[model samples]
Target: MSSISDHPLRYKLANELHARPFPSMKAPCSAAYVAIKQPEDAVSRDRAQDLAHLTALLDRHGAPHPQPGATHYYGQIGKYWLKWEQHTEFVTYTAFSDGVVARPFDPAEFDVFPSDWLENAPGQRMTSILLNIVPRPAEDVAVTGSLDEWFVSESLAASEVLDGAAIMAGDFRIDLNGHLRFAVFAGAQTGARRIGRIVQRLCEIETYKTMSMLGFARVRALQPGLNELDTKLTGLMGTMSDERASAEETLHDLLSISAELETLSARSSFRFGATGAYEALVDQRIAALREERFQGRQQFGEFMMRRYAPAMRTVHSAEARLEAMSSRSIRASNLLRTRVDVERSAQNQTLLESMDKRSDLQLRLQRTVEGLSVVAISYYAVSLVGYLLYPLTQATGMSKGMLTALATVPVVLLVWWLVRRLRKSVE
Candidate 1:
């Protein structure tokens, strides 16, 4: 009987009954389905149909009929009343109210009457009628609870307990305000042939307002999440810059110290003299100084070269590559400085070497000129001596001019040979 019962009235009853907080309050012969919805809504249309079906059934059967203007039905079967508020619906019955007011419904309400009471009672299946009263609304419905002996009335409204066959097929809770809530869901359809038909319609509600409320709350609280991240990144950048500058300063200091030590090396070695112990002590001091300078300078240089320079280069490159930048001037200045420093250092080295070469060449030229002067002076002196000695040679029968010429020849020849040998040595 339960398997075959798929009437619209039955479905509507089941949905409404499932939504009931107390099954014991269910009217014996009366059931109602109310849909609280705005006009022009599909839910409202469905509600109207449900009302009409129950109304018709109540009129046909001897059930508690509706009183004058209200949507109440009272008859021999049962009594039912349904009301629709703004976007909310309520269904109530004498049996449901009573059961909720007292406790769980007596099993006798679902059982057959005794033979003695059947004299005036109609012959009917108690389970069948009771099942019929269990309206199976075509809508998905969730019961708040079943009012039992142990359950409290206040708990009924608060508790989300539910029942009925496939009662919560698609129902969900709508958290309106503190504990007070309502069940919201789409409609459902019947058996095998209705398989392809959708049992519920999906509603794409605008939940942005709900989400916005949460966002607003969070913003008001001023959670440190976003702010903390920004602070952390800024602090990290500052720490990096500080470390780089410190390293560069340390490296510069070490290089200066090394240059000073190298300048003092000659003086220090002289002070040690030829004494082995003193020399060893001097050597030890020089080595210690060198090691200290080497380690300090190398470490600083390595740190800057490997990390700072690359980071600086990357920052500048990225800045230049950017079509637009918030801080372009600063990056460009650092880049310009780096190029200028390299160029100036090269120029200084070249100038020093040029001066050294000029001094060397000037000394060599002076030495060559001095040797030439000596040769010229010696030739003049030898010529004069030869002239005076020519008279002494007159007794040997040689002419004075001839003897002088011969003396001049030997003198010129000897001077030329000596000059050639001097030039060769000098070259």
Candidate 2:
């Protein structure tokens, strides 16, 4: 029997699907999460730096290092379980512990990561969070009171998700310690895996939300330039109809605009695309929670709709506007190029006509000069013949006047025929 060949990446690709397994944990746990991203060109930043940073943290705990070039890792670090993941534009470190500290959502809880290790990170912190997982209170009043004390009521989103398996609340705001806060109240009957899924979704939502906002920030920065370009493009288009404007000049301006737009597009393409992908993840993670309103408070979906989604929409609008402007500039450039070509063609045609007229005048002048030359040559020939024939006329007793007159006609005829033959040969 012949054996079937397998693709080289078949197993590797399949395993990659499950590489980042959700962390399984029970209630009464706390997590410190931080996402680090380079301030500039994060997507293309050195991935080795991310790994080295992770190694530094692991070395501090005397834990074994991850395999070379590993994009993700999960292992015990002292009392905490550390989960590390390297994403396209950022790296995430999450440390989970079995129990909370004395204070709820305290800044010290995030001290699980050594200050020196964090200070030596390869990139800036895009986001950092303090997350707490606790058992749900027996009464709704107690839950509301705790949420009121812990979060800002106006921006807070509290939701009972997974059919009341858990209630999650967050104000979506950074606290005095420069960290976002989220709390989860899982039912006693909630399985560890379900609780893990809930926690995973929360972290994902926050991370993606922050990432997506980067696109909004880009749009805000691009607004003034976009407006200026729009105005310039409009003016240049109007110049196309102005007879006084040179087509070449208009085309030059148009090309400049097109090039600028292309540069903007090139710079923004990855960011906008990544932002879109991150936004979708945020939406999917929130939706996967199967949220229901908690005690008539806002749900995660509502909060996003009110606060998060508009920024995403603005990003979309900016992308659309940029594309429109680029398309407009391209069309305008093409039209201007055609107009310039037509103008040049017309100028060349006029030049060709002028050259033809000059050529015709030169030919006429040359023919006139040729005619005068033949006449002048005949006069000399006749004079030379008369001198030679004067002796012959005396010897033959012919009249001198008659001799000269007869010879003149023959000599002039001969000279005219010679000149005609030479002109024909030259022609």
Candidate 3:
């Protein structure tokens, strides 16, 4: 048999898994990460513009460009290893340098992305972080003391992750420099790949957490409009139950409310769905860290549960409320439509009965007219017969009165018969 031909996408599909490889990094290094998205319709934004932006940055460092339609790019840019990945609603850029700066989480590190270039960016930044990685210090107390000086003691969450391959700490707060900070200390024997994974997870957690919060904002903004619509819908539904209200009018109002609700749902559906996905990813990444408490410090999972879970719950509640309102409006509309249909059916029945009564009256009037018509025709026929039989009376010796009387009976009978025959034919 001839060799089997491979599917066109076979190689591409197989390579997808390894397409965005984790950035391998040793300890004593730092990474700058940023994610950007359009303020509106980010998912459907022009990919070419995004590619152009990336190309512009690469050109600044005289670096090679990515493939025409590539969704990811990894290359050396100046003194840093730059990784760029395009996502459905956003894009992320990470730059990893070989060594840490003298000052921990230095603001200057983010300057690698030039301010002028950022000014002309296709979208606003969703989140940006300065991450520092160092070898695990022998003195745990000294590291803890440093963390206390660097981050707010109350908000800081420090923990050992990846089964103690590394210890990570961050306050999850924006510093004066407008960048979040993260510190990771890898075990001396930890593999570079493990360190890379830890850094990747940190970036993901922050990015996804921020993205998920967007849903919260959307829900909050929708509340006032939702309340207004709810009130209007409730009033309209109340009117439906009122005997005096016109069913047609009630149905019209109900349909209007339903349309508004549908519009709202349409506007927010994508954001809500994306929020759920991002929230799930945030949880998954946190779980993947396999975090453990460090020196009694609150672990990442604990902090998220305490602070983040409530917002997610609020978003869920809002979504549920919206869905319930929509369903209720639809139900009310259906009921109103039924009411209108029944009323119309009853009106039609009454109209048909009235039409039947009119038809009966018209039939009675027609029969009376036909009776009069026969009598009149018979009288005229008798008069004409008397005139024509005046000469015949003299020859047959029959009197005029007798001949006239004789013709009257037959003529009356004949007119009656003709009228009956015509009526039968019409019927």
Candidate 4:
């Protein structure tokens, strides 16, 4: 064999694809499905708590424990088959049992999950569903009658799916028992796996639909605040063109608005992204059903398009508006900052010119002062020389006045030369 080593995650990654296998379920059965999620910060929640919660349920049924750190589990729990799956932000529990109860979509069937166990769940229920799977009757008229009786006539969405392998119906409404209901009728020759897939798709549709609506709720709550911010930003932008307005102050206000918008975006980004993903999953599952109209009732896809599509569009609109506002604010802020800098530059240039003029005047005045100093120093030196030459004149019969005049010219010249030398040395 070659000596090349395998990547550490190679085996683990390959096994993950088959981790959650589809349940093989037969007709004439019932399933109770529940999805739970923590109210906040669910994605980063401690996995140990979730494991402990699963272990508690398993212990109640005397079921064998799943492997350590398992993300999904399928095992028999008493008379029912329990499937538990841990997701990024939620966990789902589905219990399947053979045969439906006496009452159609009876709430009592949900008791497969003990009341105390549900009460002690790590998180609140995001959604709970009661699914009834039964063999299709010989006639379509009988199925119509059952659909009418089981679900509301106005909202009932019934469809023949998988090329008549099954017919499914649901009103997508919560009943008095606080559970969404779905009824599936499998064809006589339909395989168990096909029936199982249909059931799973129904469950997924309900779960994902509910999850996507959360984004709608968040957007609805954000609308008023968004409006207020929009108005404030508009007013602030108007001030940009006002020459009297302080650019620095306007920039500060713009930054504050930008910060608020970013905060809102940060808060809502996860929900919006998750909603898009969940909506896509819902659409995929419905399409996989290959639904066609049954008894002139709306198909699942049609119902979602009519009712669910509008809310998703609203969420998209809000997200778009937020981004646009943020961009506009940033552009305005940059423009204001540039304007402020330009104005400061101009002021600095004018101030520098004024300083240069003052320096020129000071230099001229210093030159005049230096000339007077040289003349004064020469006068003092000539006087002192005259007094010393008075004595010489007496001894040599020479005039004192002539000596003083001669000394004066030389002294002034020497003083001027000395001052020039000192100035050059300093320079």
Cα TM-score per model: 0.19, 0.92, 0.94, 0.94
Rank the candidate models, highest TM-score first. 3, 4, 2, 1
Candidate 4 C-alpha lDDT tens digits along 263-372: 99999999999999999999999999999889788999999999999999999999999999989889988998999999899999999999999988998898899899
Model 4 deviation from native, Cα RMSD in Å? 2.2
| Best model per TM-score | 3
Pitting candidate 1 against candidate 2, the one with the higher TM-score is 2
Q: Better model by TM-score, 3 or 4? A: 3
- Clashes in model 2: which pairs? none
**Model 1: per-residue Cα lDDT at residue 271:** 20
> Compared with the true structure, what per-residue lDDT tens digits does model 2 show for residues 1-427?
9999999999989999999999988888999999999777554699999999999888888999999999999999999999999998899998988875578898888888878888889989999999889899898888888899999999999999999999999998999999999999999899988988898889889999999999999999999999999999999999999989988888998999999999999999988999999999998998899999888888999999999999999999999999999999999999889888898999999999999999999999988997898789888987888888888976888877778888888988898898889989998
- The CA lDDT of each predicted structure is 0.33, 0.92, 0.92, 0.91
Which one wins by lDDT: 3 or 4?
3
Model 3 whole-model lDDT (C-alpha atoms)? 0.92
lDDT (Cα) of model 2: 0.92
lDDT of 1 at 230: 32
